[model samples]
Target chain A: MVVASRKAAYHHKDGEMTETLVKKNMSASRTSAVPNYRGQQVELGRETVGNVRCANPFMVAENVNVFYGDNHAIKDVTLEIGKKEVIALIGPSGCGKSTFLRCLNRMNDSIESARVTGNISLDGGDIYDKTLDPVVLRARVGMVFQKPNPFPKSIYDNVAYGPRIHGLAGDRAELDDIVHRSLERAGLLKEVKDRLDDPGTSLSGGQQQRLCIARTIAVNPEVILMDEPCSALDPIATARIEDLMDELCEDYAIVIVTHSMQQAARVSRRVAYFHLGYLVEVDDTDKVFTNPHHKLTEDYITGRIG
Target chain B: MPNQMTSRARVEAGLSRRKRKEKIFRASGLLATAIGILFLGIFFSTLVAKGASAFVQTYLLLDVELTAETIAPGGELDLEYADFDGLVRTALRNNFPELSGRNDRRELNRLLSVGAGFQVRDLVVANPDLIGTTQEIWVPAASNVDMLMKGNIDATVDESLRNLSDRQIRWIDTLDQAGRVDLRLNKALFTNGDSREPELAGIRGAMMGSFFMLVVTIALAFPVGVAAAIYLEEFAPKNRWSDLVEVNINNLAAVPSIVFGLLGLAVFINWMGLPRSAPLVGGLVLALLTLPVIIIASRAAIKAVPPSIREAALGLGASKMQVVFHHVMPLAMPGMLTGAIIGMSRALGESAPLLMIGMIAFIVDVPGGFTDPATALPVQIYLWADSPERAFAERTSAAIIVLLAFLLLMNLAAVILRRRMERRW
Candidate 1:
């Protein structure tokens, strides 16, 4: 039965490839169309791939299904997250994009009657391991929220919060250094250094968003998952964060879930487009934006549908 | 266009009705304000007319020689002793040197207070050097003299019941003319502790007792009430047990304060055999009465804390406990303190429960500790107000003033704390 299921998964992949070819040719406009490459190999040979490797290709998804009371939120969808890459999960409202993000760090556990199923693993390592503390796992995989939420505490404390929780600093001086470096990486240190003790909430919306990024980076997570982190900020804050993401790629694998197609194009090296709990297409960011392979992906990239 | 015109007419009709209703409401509000002001005016005037004369006390000062031979006439024996009454009478007679052959001195002696002797004895013992020395002592006059000083005495009374003889009355007249016998304002009437003598009794002890009791109430109730509120409002599940607990808390708040006093009588005093009339027992009872009020108010305050703050804390990797204690508690503090102050103020004015548990009048010395027998301000007022002695009327009024002052202080504290903790969001 296991072998049969494995074979079925491969067949599903082949069928998806054929659908990609059909979608690219059928698109009315390139603006709305993700150009589908039929039989065109994505040569992730030398330059595209990196030194980082995932321990296992087979992502074990155990009984993972979500429900909001009688309403079935996310179906029993299973997928693997590969190392040294980006995976963007997209869906319309109530399709469970945020729910899935919460499940990654057991953030869903806080919500009442919001049940989750299926065990998602990173390199076959049980993320929901019995001995694994959620706080520790959260430290390993940091998340950036949709809204810019900074503590009423000082700007320095806002960035240093995660580091303090994880005991990442040797002393006050070291913690201060970490806060400085993280803020610098987020492109906010220069603007806020003179008033380090000023409340983080006192900053502009864009600065607050950058402060949140600086906070996430202070803990030094292996994977950074952003959930529409730029949605609440102005276009300038959004652009600055996108540029920060480009700079972050060398040190950590970044997975960003964004509503803006232009933002995905500007920031991500690679992009995986999702539609209704299915990975429609995965390719270079430029190709996915200028030319999508799936019908839904193309429709979404343009103004046709989301 | 016809439908639009009809809809506009309907809107106009609704607006006209609303305006008419507003007029009626304003008229009724004015009536209510007049009624409220009338009631307050009546209350103030009634209290002033009935209570004003109680502030002044009639006193007699005389040079009483404290000779050990006269005090201990028979000399030393078994227990310690002093003839304080003999000393007081001799001092009064000595002050009136012309009363040697007259029987008016006996009737005139009745004008002195019962505790006047105790006052002289205490003074002599305190300053032993005055044992053989002549000391001018000031002591409260009798209740009759107090009435006479306040002009409450009727000169046309029936001869059979008229206690003061014409000669003694003449001496009183002479004293009055000399300005040695006059009604002076008594500061200690509101500031001193209770004593057996009506003249010596004051609300100060009961005030301290109530103050200390309220301190204990705030210390115990604030933390427990806020913790319970936080747990119930923020973290506890909406199961049957928690729901039942919530219901019980509401019901407990409505239970009569006397019921809690009874509980204290049984559990704290009888069962535990704690000292009766102690402020600790009284405080514990009042705390029980105030706890439910505090819990309900704190829960409302905690509920008023926006969920966004909790989300913000949780998203920052703070645990569930941290989210509440750090963010939620600080935001809810001002409201909690206000609730606590109000609850404590309510507890202070309560008399029935304190009366039920022997807090009526532990009249002696001031309370030295929690275990010491003490009366609360309201309880002292109740005792004085119930006394048959007409002189106690003034003391009762004075007690009410003290109680009112304390309530004002607590309310002021609530306002200041509420303002201090006010936040923008």
Candidate 2:
């Protein structure tokens, strides 16, 4: 938490008078048995979500803020997603975790009223610049939605959409190979080996999610964004998708937004906790779950408040 | 739980009452459906009964001694001087030797159609040997005589009110008894074009007109309507201008068909110099009539494509155009085709706009092309309906069967297309 140290040092130099004031207000509010965070002026951490940093980062998001028309949905949050790592963004519903994840790939651009102000870079090249097309950016950085939305096409075409769109495959054999490799990586090849001509919607929920994962990776993207990819699935299906996510991390940096704390602890190497449109705390997954650095993070992890 | 239980008799009564109500509801529903089917059955049965006679024709047998004097009056086969009409008259006279006066002979001559003379002329021109020797031949009886033979006319009615004289009916009955008159299935009814002689008229010209007109209408309206719908539903930004266009399209669908005919008359015929009664103009007018319906249907179909599909395609780097054409359009096709079928059925049965565009013209030649002067099936029906001939009334019903058949085939094609192309997501 480098931001926390810089803010702490600045606050320590200026806190001689306000420290006494804060202490007096803290005692005054505590007399009522409910701590008044506003009156006591509790210090907040300016750290990135998941304080773990990589020496070679694939993508870095800086000072990302999002607004939906009149509503401020995401605050200034900075985070770096490392290559070949699984980072889970866990928070209660409407806490800007999904919004922050959407901002990473400029998925926010689809909403007419959504306004995003941020600097997101892939290999240090600005993704928001006018010259780079969104079509190309999305090809390099793919996303999987919570509800599986397979195109009204055959199973083979679903995995082949990305490669076909980008013209990544040279011929039918190459395209078939890409589809095979993608489905194999998603762990869906064996069950669907014979029925690739069947509709993609014919799959079970977990299988559909895996198919979506296969579709995303068929483009060979460097980063994969998953917005609660297993939320619509059963526990068993959810576990299978989680396992698939674990395997996918070896090839691509993945940012997943999840509601399950146990899922974050089990699958992600790092976890970032969000609250009220702010990045409250981030650290190693075990540290954030067992001993959070921020009071909000601790409340969320222990089920005291969400 | 024991206290909550109803008495056995009361429970049985309640159950029976509910069952009775359901039975009444089902009976009423069945009765409604049966009434509709009964009406359709009566209409089709009556139509088939009346129109069945139009498919058969009656012929009169004639014998004549043809020599050089009757055919080639000057030595060579001279069609201009050939006494084909006189030869037919002499043949009728020979059949009824009791006929003496010119008035009686003229009444007897009326039994043969005016076209009989042309048949003889053609026979002599084709083979002069036929003119030099007597040969028995069967020629189409006059329309009234044909109707009398077919039992279409009331023989008991007085001769003054009927189209035939008592003597003429006697001659027809005698010919029938002697097996000299025959009722054969009229292949000419399917092959020939409109004629003042009702016995010779057929629906071929009208069927061709309808085919050409529908081709033009569908070719013009389907793609344009679908494109307009895609732009309006998927690409158009929300604003007053687009809203106005949408409102106008809805309004256009409700306008009278005859008004489109008027538009075709004024614009396509007068301003554009297109031929009146041409299927090209009539089809353009019908396309105008159908375009809004197609657009409205296509828009609903496009809207039926789920937003999730759009998001999924976009999420995978598919462009907006790809999302629409590759995903949205295919998903929406069955519904769009269903709408187009509805519009085409309406167009197939439409007559008012065709009338306004002069499609009620009595086209004599089967339409060779779209620009030829033509009459669609329904307009042909209208023209036949207004004619005073009894055979035309039967022919009108026949034309209705043809129109309805075309509509059915079109609807079946649409259903097949939908079933073949439909994609379930």
Candidate 3:
């Protein structure tokens, strides 16, 4: 019991050092929230918009910011994602929700003008460390985009893409099993089992999105990030995807960005709300919908302001 | 009621005017398309009418007895030493029994082709038993007689300006009346070499030269252009240096083709010391001329591939190289090939650059290799077009038709490939 208590003390001390570091890095503009806070400057103690830590996190983003040339796209954002949980990021348009989601796997590296600056770690390893490669990092943390961008290939090939590139399968038979298992887990086996050779694009929109989900999990990533996976989909398709996400969170840590307030409450245990480029609030899904702590979060969930 | 009627009449008048304008616009569009088709039809028909005669040429029939005296000097059949030209003159003399003056004999000899002797000689050599017998065979008529037999040279024209003399025309008429003159398909037009005699010239050498040059040009341009396009479009940063490259590439496309010729002359000829009229140098020059065109086209093709595909590949943990090669390039391939076809056709039609590279040498033999002395079809037509012979004009039009056919075939391939490979999504 002494060793455990002392270890907790050491963790708190480390947390204090990180808090001081966060204070030191905050520019003058980030010290206070906007005047919608009744013209009162909120205290900057430990400087968090919401509950930003957990007992053991699968991924941690500390004091992260993103810029595009002169545009500060994301500002001083800090969040931690726990394993076996579905966390939904919710916000108005252009509030850097998708930007932060991409930061998890370094998908922003492909954008020419995007510049991300912060401490981001997966399983306590710095993802931005010069020794780490983004390609391998991405295998550990997969992503699903807004559209069902199934590759211009067969459904089998689409699911097998990650396996082929990383050499996860030793032979064609093994590869087929991974594809079949991934499709089964994505809840698409009943429909697509008979025509695995058909193009992924030949399926309906919902089927195509499920194919993308199957492709992502086939790589066996520890965490999955979906960027508004249901925006282009209909109501029925969106509900199906939400159901898939709930089932998937049993095995993998899931972070999803969505515009719908009800989708966050329905699918995720925790919700993160962003305003402009600022991350405003993060709390339990019930607490955020009923008793948001920040004024911007209240204004947004109440439908008064964004 | 009167005011309502006036307003209704005005609105109806306005509506009728707009509808009439729409119909006029549609009719004008149809008329413009018809005019373009009419011009194409007129051009094609004119070319066919002018060049169809060149496929067949006039020939003269003569009877000759190959005596042992002419075939052999010492009673032994010596085929190599035979006096075939003597036998030809003898046959003409025996047929007409004309005046024996040297001038008259020369005029009669001019009625037959210089190739007539070789025709009789080859026949006799092929069948040695016919040496002591008389046989009637048709050999090519002289170019002037050929023109007269084909009705290309008008007898109504003044005798001074016409290449054929009055007596030569009369002999041709007599031969025609006797059924001794015939128009056989001009196999020589395909089999022979470039000649001072337009009747003997053929495009085989030029066609072969063009084939070699085009092979070299495509081999050099297609890969280099695609690689450069991939580098510029996918990898190059948006900086001043990249901007300069982009500007220069666009500028190079508008640079006159003759400038590329001068560049080839300075670089490939003066500095490199390549053979002047060789298809190798001409092909290299053409490759340089087409590189800019291909690069511009390939860049557009690469650009036309959607960005969502790249994002999808990247989201799947694909490396940048995999994203480009596996997804982007396959999607963009059909467009790249279309661009390549357009650039190559442009190279095929280019004559000025090859001319500047010195492909204007008077070539005789078909190009046996890339480095041999050669001329392309356009250069051949250029050379033939400058000739004083009336027959070369027909050959010039024929070469144009052949060039158009080659371009048409490449365009058809581009269309077929696009249809086969194009994906709707």
Candidate 4:
């Protein structure tokens, strides 16, 4: 009885930390949401959207909702993914974390039954706009799936597929360079450089995941969406990928979906907790893990509910 | 441990029971094999017994004096003296001298193939140098003579009932003794092409026509079918209309090939005014027949390519068109080709529809274009099978053998291509 009670007490203490964290992050965002009249007044003469601090907030999703047939897969969720920040979405299965991640690059548009509403913008331009080509949007907003889905092609060809398709490289030599650089960034070049002609599937599961990441990076996307990218990996591989994610955050804005609470806290600069297709709370990673406002977020973080 | 032991015992018991069942199954399998072999044995024996004699042919060797007086007037190579029937009669009289005194020379002439004149004409044309030179020519005899050589005819039958007289039989016997009658195997029967003369007709022209038709079929059906399949399977919106189209495509594959032939006749022949008896028309009809097969196969192949591939391509920023053509098309090509060849093989053997579209025409020259007059092997077989001549029976069987050989070759090529090219993800 004492052990069970002690476990409950530990859960409760964790809950209090999450609550305080949510309050602080939301407060800072609330102030930033308002018009910057004080900055305009301080300006010498010229003022424009560029002069504003929020001019290029990396990614801004406003009232995003997704439906698949009759099921409401995602509710109206509003969030801002700041430049070079690692934002992790933590949720139980089918809670729309992956759905929301796909919406970042309009990947859901490929699904015939899926219908997305509202604006999801990368650097202020609406990504879901009628004029925007999904192909170009996807090139700029790269994605990595849950499973290590390296194409049944050579490692070099796998990484080069994106650059070749988008005509990102100037020539074959340039494409080879892009492939090498991308693989190096993904931390797989050293291991696979000698066997570049080998099939992508010939690699280990963790290596295949990194290969997929390299393939995504070949297009030089400004943002990366990782949907449980490290789930189909071992502890060693997972740790390596997490470290890579931290380094990737310096150059590209990243949104990751993870089931592991520790992974969410360790990797992400900011964390969003989702429950039943709703974004329950969003805050800085440390604060969200330490203190949350929403009761559901508290329950999930403390292992009381999911 | 208890559960493991219990499971192990159960597995052993199950294995014993399975062993017993397998024994029974093997016994029944052997019985089925025996039955199959028995049936096959009967079928093959019947076929060989009935068709074996058809392979052998009889030839009449005649030592004729090729005098310039008979062949050409004024000792010149006159094309006018190339009267085929006159030359054949002169040769026949030279072989059987007893027939020279016979009153019923017309009856004696009937023993020789009515179309023997054509063979003689061909020989003269081929060797205009052979004029005025005495040569022993071994020419094909009539089918009745072939049957006689094979011992299928008896001489001791009733005088009134028999077509040939005892004296004519004596003449044939004397000619056989004098080495003037040559009853050798006829290889020309299989290698030659269609002719009005039953003795000289072969399936060569029809075989080439079928090949050309199948070529056109592959060229036409493969691209259109696979493209349509890719659009339907990968790119097209999955709405009610596409669903309806999918269902309709499935139904079209099941529709009788004859119906497609009728449709081709109406649309390709009457409506488009395509040349009748041309391989082009035949090919078009066959392609229409083959299209649905190829489409269904290609769709299945495209579907067999896992959705993960499409997602991966899309994730990599490849457009929908690129995803289909670059990845899906290569994967689906083998199945499409296999299906196309199978469909074309079926088309090769199709006769009823080709007959309705005037593919049964007795053509001698090889087809030059899609619009050229031609007959397919099966259509040639059909035409020969319908003829009242006794000799046409063997010709029809020979045509079937050729058609079967072509179909087998096509199927083998399909198998080889599929094995070599088809890649499993």
Mark the regions of model 1 whose C-alpha exceeds 4 Å error after superposition. Answer: A1-63, A80-89, A255-261, A269-306, B1-14, B26-56, B63-84, B94-103, B121-137, B151-173, B185-187, B190-192, B422-425
Error of 1 at A109 (Å): 0.8
Please provide, for model 1 over B55-87, each residue's C-alpha lDDT reduced to its tens digit, 9 standing for 90 to 100: 878888777877768665464321155677878
Model 4 over residues B1-425: C-alpha lDDT tens digits?
99999999999989988999999999999999999999979865665554566666777776655677776777666677556666666777766555545566776676677666666667777888887877677777776676667666676788666556776677678768888677566666666778776666767678778878888888899889988988898779999999999899889888877888788789988999998888888888888888888899888888888777788889878898999887777777888888878877788888777876888887877676677899998888888889876667766766666666788999999999999987645
Roughly what TM-score does model 2 have, to 2 decimal places?
0.85
In model 4 chain B, the worst 10-residue window by lDDT is B95-104
A1-306 in candidate 4: lDDT tens per residue? 213323433555533323243233333332222111122211111111111123348888876767675455665677888898888998778789999999998778888878777677888799878898899999998999999888778999999999998988899899989999999999999999999999898999899899999999889999999999888899999998999998898899999999998899889978887765657678778877777665556657886323
Each model: TM-score of chain B?
0.87, 0.89, 0.90, 0.87
Which ranges in model 3 have alpha carbons more than 4 Å from their true place?
A1-27, A30-48, A304-306, B1-28, B61-80, B83-101, B119-138
- List, for all models, the DockQ compared with the true complex: 0.23, 0.60, 0.52, 0.47
For model 2, name the residue pairs that clash. Answer: A50-A282
What digit string (tens of lDDT, one per residue) describes model 2 on residues A1-306?
223323443555543323343333323332222111233333454444347456668888876667675455675667778888898998778889999888777778778767777678998999899898888989988999989988878899999999999999999999999999999999999999999999999998899989999999999999999999988999999998888888889889899999888888889988888875667677778888878877667666776434
Q: Which 10-residue span in candidate 1 chain B carries the lowest summed lDDT?
A: B72-81
Instruction: Name model 2 segments beyond 4 Å from true.
Output: A1-57, A69-72, A75-77, A275-278, A293-301, A304-306, B1-28, B63-94, B116-138
RMSD (Å) of each candidate, 1 decimal = 8.5, 7.6, 7.3, 10.1
Top lDDT model = 3
Error of 2 at B178 (Å): 1.1
Q: Give the alpha carbon lDDT tens digit for every residue of B290-369 in model 3.
A: 88988998899889888878877787788989988998888889988898889889988889998898888888888899
C-alpha positional error of residue B172 in candidate 2 after TM-score superposition, expressed in Å: 1.0
Ranking by lDDT: 3, 2, 4, 1
| DockQ-better candidate, 2 vs 3 | 2
